[model samples]
Target: MSERVMPGHTDGLITLGAADALWVDLTTDSAVPTASGAFTSSPAQARMGYVLLGGHAVATVRAGDGRWSVSEGEVRRAAAALNAVGMDRQDLVRIGPFRGAPRQECDEEAPLRWRRRITGELGGPERAARREVGRPYHLAGIDWRQILVEQTRDGTHRTWWLPRAVVRLLDAAEHAETQARDAGDRQTTNPEGPTATPRPYNKELEGQLYSVLSRKPGTSRRVAGWACAVCRGAPATVLDHCHEHGYVRAPLCQSCNTLERPDHLYSNDIRVANRYTRLFHTDTDDWLRHWHRCPGCRARTTLPLPHLAAWTAHIACRSLRPTHRAPRGRKPCGVLRVSWTGSQNAPRSGLLTVAVDCCPSGEHRVLAQVPYREAAERFRIWLAETAPALAAAAGPDPLDGLPAQSRPVIADTSGEGLALF
Candidate 1:
């Protein structure tokens, strides 16, 4: 693998230190951004530090002489940066509300409030490279949580650690969320809030998009006549945005933007759009014609969600009659593991996770979750069509694994499925 590149900040440009720097907003075209600051110490680091440290950010740190003399401007920028990450002013910066210090928010915290959670210096000369013992790649995907950076550039070379209180709060939050989930079900109660607040739109992002469009002559006006920004084939028209956040996501064609829209809409995450498009195309007849073989059993299968349901149901119904040997003796084979890049399942939308593993050992890796309703449809359809065949030789189904169950039977319809009796 190639070594990672660290970027620096150019004048008048706002640097985004997150891994998905491309998704970062630009105030204007003149605010030219560089990748240098993304690696080394910069304002973005402190902002990330403040958040990761659980909102305890002080403007200044103690000097060698033991005098706390950090600038007010630096502190204000730190507060602004913290607020930018989906926090409201009320959640962070406080004014004239404390009993002790006049500037409670700044003075309440101990010295060097912003602390680094991820290990190792970001990057630098051979000395810094040696510190990286498999460093967690600075950016934490679409979670929007940035890595905290410590400004140790000063000759002192001091190291900072998270205060005990902050660690407890983060641990508690995680534990509560975990207990609430039951086999893919969402948390019954949210620690975040009764109803989560909507995030503000990013002007820097808007300007960045305008810059990309304005690069070529009349591209803005020409987009309506061209293909979608995502699939890049269908004619484009509508502007995709989060109905909740009221922010523009992208300029997509009708199909790309319409999956689970309005009610199931996700924020403007780059990965989600890509995943949605992949699953969307897979459901089409064209994609099905090109089949993939499963790695576990080496069986060429159709789209998993439906194909799995179909094959399983056929085996189930065939065993209901008799003469068909029990399949429990055979090994329970054929497993598919699916990792989704995005979803309407809010909390997990941006994070890459294992959505489902079909069959047994989790072998076939798919990129999207199979909708529950669609899977059920395949089972019902297969059982209906194969009812009459259960007695016809009782030939073994290549996919059967589990033994049969006796249940209400559908009338045998192998001939035409038209008997109303």
Candidate 2:
């Protein structure tokens, strides 16, 4: 043991032998001081040893021969000096000279005191090994002074320098772990977790299947089936659940999952519409009109119309649409005729027209005209059949001003003589 170093002790650097360890004696006024200081001799040394003198002090240690002095106002300068000499928190080993205060007093004041000292002496919590101990000191009316020791290794001899690369990797790993822990904490605290349990269906498996299909873009049913079986999901369009667990898996295609429901199936319907739209490079509106239905409400209304324009823009940028061509024998359906009549002798009808000049070569030209009411009915039926599971899953419709069993239909009819049924 050596005599305690005073506040204005002479600044000096020294090297320790292989069998010897450097020691520091720190003295301060209170156990929780506002400022502190440390000293080291060599810039290369990474570890140090510390001892408490008369007064109490909080101390951090590292491996090094460098010497430093810290106090209420000079703690930051001392730490900066150590950093300027290439010494960091990882180089520290132990801290001492602390007269432990009562747990209540420490709990209230130690954090604030520690935070300030850390800011000045250790940079932050990341750089130091922290400890608090109650030990008797010779000095009177003084609580403690902060002291630090660092360590490094050389060959078989333990010294105080930590490799910079190791320090960096450890820091990164610590950061990643901290982020993951934070995410887990948030998940646990979320109110929705208690009320809305995630439909446990193996997202990783689904992602794997998505990866396979996304790679080929147009894989066959057999290939898709094999992949789906391995991935544990339904095919690419229909919704499947674990029969034993009721957990919803990824959807299968309509051709693959033939189950139908009397009500709307929201999830399956959305999946099917989105899937076929991706496959055909067609707009969501087109997919919904030709294939999709609402499972929540069993509605055949243009489900994708709201998102159609955005989807179109996205797919267009991807160059997914086919080139336009002229029809072989008929023209293109470019014009639509709508008629409305309020008289008893006349009826209302809407007719769509085809322009023969714009028809694609070798393609058949057929005019597709339907009554608004009929279209609506077809859409409802499509929804009930395509996404039966979704309909069941939804339990009940949430929309306002709509019946649970029926949906409104649109009628498209020409204003002609009102003689026919």
Candidate 3:
């Protein structure tokens, strides 16, 4: 067999025939150098013949002749060897002569292995064609071998048929890209003054604004006004740097700004309370509670309070509570008396009462007259079971609605009120 060496960063594409089958000698130090060609070539005549002798890289071989095919197992082995050599699956781009042959067992196992090796490397796999042929050494000197391979990157222009309106929108996006580039260039160059610092642009703010507009909620002027409100200033002159960095001072109202004080927002006590409440509501709370410590004050006094009336109402509606009407005949079967005691100094003051009667001879009967507190405990148990189901039925859980990383944590503790609770 004759051998040749072509050296460069550019891809080497060699065409081989039956008699011109390339014998790849990878044992040499310079055969497949770390910086040079890290690939191999062989002919797929009557049998697929390509040996990965020795190299710290992957080898891709395609059949030149249409007589032989490459099996998926071969591709998988090649990929595995490459991976062992510290090369990622993505490093092996393509392998194949990809000529023509009769249809046979495509041996999809290889491609699947390739997928497993390179799962999530890209979004997913693309569609491609395959062929099969005969060879001398098919798995130990057989007559035929199955060859399966796909193109790494084809320069095929994929034309997307779009509606005229969509085409117009795409044209608008192209124009926007051009305008953005021009704006960026302008921002970089201080052409007007000699020593003036170029104003830094906020890409995040621009993106956020773009997101709002893409919804097409209202007119540009109205949207601009809302953006200004968010910025807490004239939208045109508002330097967006602070807003982009999550500085709450930008778009909030004065009241909200005051409410979101440094002491209040980042307080360890508040963070711990919030986290405790969140944990109390989630199924993962059991696991998270062990590791859940306030990063702010490093305190562990946080507790979940039933402050949300709406949630309480939801719990009450789902519980087996009695109706408003009293029973007709007085029967000493069982009585469920519920009463609410209000604190005198509480913001909201009210007394609530509920009574349930049990039927003596009927299938349904009350067990005992339990305290409202006990009933509340029972409600909590029911919530622990049914809240998730109710959340599922209502749509997504509120906790799930939070961004993956924005689950909240105290970043610092430098205040007097840094207690966890």
Candidate 4:
């Protein structure tokens, strides 16, 4: 067979076959290094060094650091050796220089072993390895093999291969630094961010919520049957319970449930709360108890008195700072925007301005511009009954014509004073 020169071929180097790529170490000082003492062209004469076998070429020298990219077929053979011992090719990334006892099969006291080294401009692994100095950590894509000893006719001699070798891979330390920088950027941009991610609807957790609510005193099932306590439009799929106090609050739709999360309702911004609690018509005490962060005591419980009067009494605090200032930025997908348009101190002074922006055409419509408390309640009723989407969700208002005794056993007409949202 005639030999054809491969692209990017080096001068004075022979193109070795794929079968010889694994055994032959490509690292050498001479123009051509052989494994054996014989100068005749043979596979066994090739020098030993770290090899990167999985590339398309039969053998390609990357650098003078004794590294070679060998053929794919040879790489699989090396990978099979690792697989035979319950090791994976990916494991090479994490296992930094196999420090454990050498394979019992090998006769030599110290045989050529795999080692990990840093290469390229991927940053230093020194600092990343500091915390785990004694332990093994992951590097990106490289593995190395130290010098091999052979008993030759002349004498026992060590190959030109270095003991502690190098390769290139994704540095774990740099990855961590990148994550920290991203977190910092998020904090700087949105100071009022959520502390935790909202959990997805869980059926098992929902059953637990129902079990707990059944034992609780004031959780009446007749309040709003089958409809979400928040947005009466969607079906009540999530059973919302206060994670801190371990008390059941109300049944909420998946969308509305996320709004009631501590992370979403973190601030004292009433407008934000109002938008979330727009259609909430349940035991107001439960809502207040779950999320009312007292301005005076800085406590998040509705203790001493768990009613509307208690919330009004605990509104003012010496250390309280105004949270209703114009937001630094607007959310990308806010469906509802609420703002107080008049004096906030006076009882009936401000107009609870509410705008709906969740339209398909992106049209922002002012749904309500009414006074606080009583007017807000009326607006909620009007929206639920008249809006095409909400009217279907509200489902004819269960209390339309039921007998006074049968309709909603609990008389909760405290929707006005319960504007604590």
Best by TM-score: 4
Each prediction's number of clashing residue pairs: 10, 93, 12, 9
Q: What value of lDDT does candidate 2 attain over all alpha carbons?
A: 0.26
The ten-residue window of minimal lDDT in model 1 covers 89-98
Error of 3 at 146 (Å): 66
**Clashes (candidate 2):** 93
Candidates in order have lDDT scores of 0.27, 0.26, 0.25, 0.30
Q: Highest lDDT among the candidates is held by which one?
A: 4
- Tens-digit lDDT string for candidate 1 (1-421): 2222134422112222332232222211211111222222222233212211112222123345543232333223322433343322111111111123222121212222121222213223542574455333222111112312133326654332222222222322222222222113221112221111112222222312232444667554344434444444344444443222222344544334433221111221111222222333444322222112111111212223222322322232223212213465543222222222332223233222222224332434333433434433443454335333322212233334312321211332422111110
Question: How well is each residue in 235-291 modelled by candidate 3, as lDDT tens digits?
Answer: 221222111111111222222222211112232112112222233355333212221
TM-score of 3: 0.15
lDDT value for model 3? 0.25
Taking all chains together, the TM-score of candidate 4 against the true structure is 0.21
Off by over 4 Å in 4: 1-238, 241-256, 259-268, 271-370, 373-421
What is the Å distance of residue 323 in model 4 from its true position?
Answer: 21
- Over 4 Å off, model 3: 1-309, 318-340, 343-372, 387-421
RMSD of each: 24.2, 26.6, 23.9, 24.5
- The deviation in Å at residue 42 for candidate 2 is 35
- Residue 311 shift from truth in candidate 1, angstroms: 20
